[model samples]
Target: NAGVTQTPKFRILKIGQSMTLQCTQDMNHNYMYWYRQDPGMGLKLIYYSVGAGITDKGEVPNGYNVSRSTTEDFPLRLELAAPSQTSVYFCASGRNQPQHFGDGTRLSIL
Candidate 1:
């Protein structure tokens, strides 16, 4: 079974464009999160959900959004993508246990 999966491993978006980064897990986790890491910087939480239909904005939620509609899916949407939003995006899920992360999506905005 897949622990966690993210689509579009790499993408290039023009400024003002938008896209949704897909994330899904088969582990039936209750907690899910989205984070972004800039070059040489630590990961900054973008958004998170403790369960389906319950989501909260994280440290750097600007320009991004997330929705958790099921135990297995948490999708991150980037609205009007900007150059500053260009970074590697990671999705993670877990219960009370340690989180498992997705491979990551490398996004570049030009």
Candidate 2:
């Protein structure tokens, strides 16, 4: 399996611009998740889906939206991005255990 991969690695956005940080997994795992980690804190769940066509909000879902249409892709959308949205985004997977993570997509807003 290719595990999870995130694009750009790093990005800088103005106060109001937006973008979709891409995430894809080659593993056939049924569970996928998106999380954001602020400095010196644990990961906060943003969104997750158990399977295709099923999705749900998570602890830090505000300012972000996600769609899980296929088994391999779960892209996160940021609209009217704000400085508070700046954080390291991580994509993960696992069924009954801890998740395997991407290096992370580091985003900064100025």
Candidate 3:
């Protein structure tokens, strides 16, 4: 059922280019999350939503924006991108303990 899907598995952007990382889930999870993982570290939460029309900034929300318009889609927006933002992004959704994750979107800034 395509539990979690992300677009543009790989992307390259200029120093100030902006892009949106798309994520959608077919599981109808009320909880959706956005995280970024650097080369050698664990994932750090960027943003999260408990349900539609509700969202909260997580540990590393700087330079990023998120909105939960529907239960299935939660997109992460990067404005005025920078080199420091180059990392692997993951989108997850779940109802409880076990969460489902998308393969990930690898972003590079030059």
Candidate 4:
């Protein structure tokens, strides 16, 4: 069974462009998170949701947003993409157990 899936493994965007990174899981997890990792750096949380109809910004939420409308999906939206936003993004989901990650999406802003 698929654990977690992410779409558009790689993408290029103009400085002002916007896009959504899609993430889905079949584990029926209630907790989901979006994180970005810069080159050679650790992951930085962008947003997270505990359950359907509930969401919250994380440590680095600028230019990004997220919504959790179901137990199986949590998508991250990037608005007004900027060079600083260029990085590899990862989506994760879990319960009290260890989180499972999706194949990261690589985003480049030029």
For candidate 2, the 10 contiguous residues with the lowest summed lDDT are 93-102
**Residue 47: error of model 4 in Å?**
0.4
Q: TM-scores for all candidates?
A: 0.96, 0.94, 0.97, 0.96
For model 1, how does the per-residue alpha-carbon lDDT over 39-108 read when each residue is reduced to its tens digit?
Answer: 9999899999999999999899999988888989999999899999989999999884338999999999
**Candidate lDDT (C-alpha), each:** 0.92, 0.88, 0.95, 0.91
Residues 1-110, model 4: lDDT tens digits: 89999998999999999899999999988888899999999999898888899998889999998888888999999889999999999999899433899999999999
Clash pairs for candidate 3: none
Report the error of model 4 at residue 104, Å.
Answer: 0.4
Q: Provide the RMSD of all predictions against the true structure, rounded to 1 decimal.
A: 1.1, 1.1, 0.9, 1.1
lDDT of 4 at 23: 96
Per-residue accuracy of model 3 over 1-110 as CA lDDT, tens digit each = 78999998999999999999999999989999999999989999999999999999999999999999999999999999999999999999999532899999999999
Best candidate (score: lDDT): 3
Give lDDT for model 1.
0.92
Order the numbered candidates by lDDT, best leading: 3, 1, 4, 2
Off by over 4 Å in 3: none
Judging by TM-score against the true structure, name the best candidate. 3
Residue pairs with backbone overlap in model 4: none
* Position 26, candidate 4: lDDT: 95
